[model samples]
Target: MTLSSKLSAARAGLFRSLGLMFIAGFGATVAFDAWGQIVSPALGFANLSPHGLAKSLLGAYGLPNSDFAGYFVHFYLVGLIGYPLGWLFVFRPVWGRVVRRGGWLLGAAAYGFGLWILAIGGITALAGLPFFLNFTGITWVALVGHVLYGVVLVAVMRAFGGR
Candidate 1:
């Protein structure tokens, strides 16, 4: 492919990847939430859900905890941040490798792990929240949830001819 053709292909692939990202993000969030609500508490977790996180942050600001706003923020971040970042970091890098020998499932799972690090290690710290607490189930949930997200995202992107 010519330089222009390559660029066009990449752009098209990016849009397709973003669409998949949107779907995967929401799916992951829903799974995470359900796990937090139904499973985490039984496993001795408290306020570990995304809604709980948002509620905590809102409490810090003396704002009321709104589930609507929390879900909106969750979905918005998936589309606005997750899509572009996934394309730039995950999709492009995975495809850019000349060898491209790894399975898409592995690549996507690795990408999701990276995202979990960024979210838990970076975002949580930046937000002044404890990265890890006494509870470990939440940690496992986040890690596995993100991995599943990557699996689904890669499956969708590959189906759509991304990379």
Candidate 2:
């Protein structure tokens, strides 16, 4: 293929990859809701869901929000950014093999680290915003949740790759 054709092909492939990854991510959200929203409350983990998870996972960068709209907006931004990140994190390894066999794990860890940093950075940048700035617990919540996200991503990558 000519360079232009190759670029077009690559773009198409990226779109496809992002679509698949987005679906996977949405599923992750649902699974998270199932446990945090449903099971957690039942198990007395009422406040141990995303709120806690984001704070813990995000660490210093973790911005905390209490309003449902705020929560969705924050995650919406994360999901949007995460779509492209999936390409950097997963595509090269699974498709190009640019990384080693453990690329998935590394990718996941990097992603977790990214979110952790985002938690602190996002909060700091938006500290003036009343919605999330007040929620000091965002650190713990994001930290824990992103850890779970990283862990699950690693598992899914392994399982899917194995299959």
Please report the TM-score between candidate 2 and the true structure: 0.54
Q: How close is candidate 1 to the true structure, as a TM-score?
A: 0.65
- Candidate 2 colliding pairs, count: 29
Candidate 2: misplaced stretches above 4 Å? 46-72, 83-103, 106-110, 120-125, 128-141, 154-163
Residue 40 lDDT, candidate 1, scale 0-100: 61
lDDT of 2: 0.52
Point to the candidate with the largest lDDT: 1
**lDDT: worst 10-residue window of model 2:** 46-55
lDDT of 1 by residue, 1-163 (tens): 7999999999987777667666655555555556556666777664356555555555566766588765555556653456446755756586559437776676777777876787666556654678753236677777766666566655655665554
> Each prediction's TM-score against the native?
0.65, 0.54
RMSD of each: 4.6, 6.9
Shift of residue 160 alpha carbon in model 2, Å: 6.3
For candidate 2, give the lDDT of residue 124: 47
Mind giving the per-residue lDDT tens digits that candidate 2 earns over 52-109? 3344434434555445535564455454345335544654446445456655666665
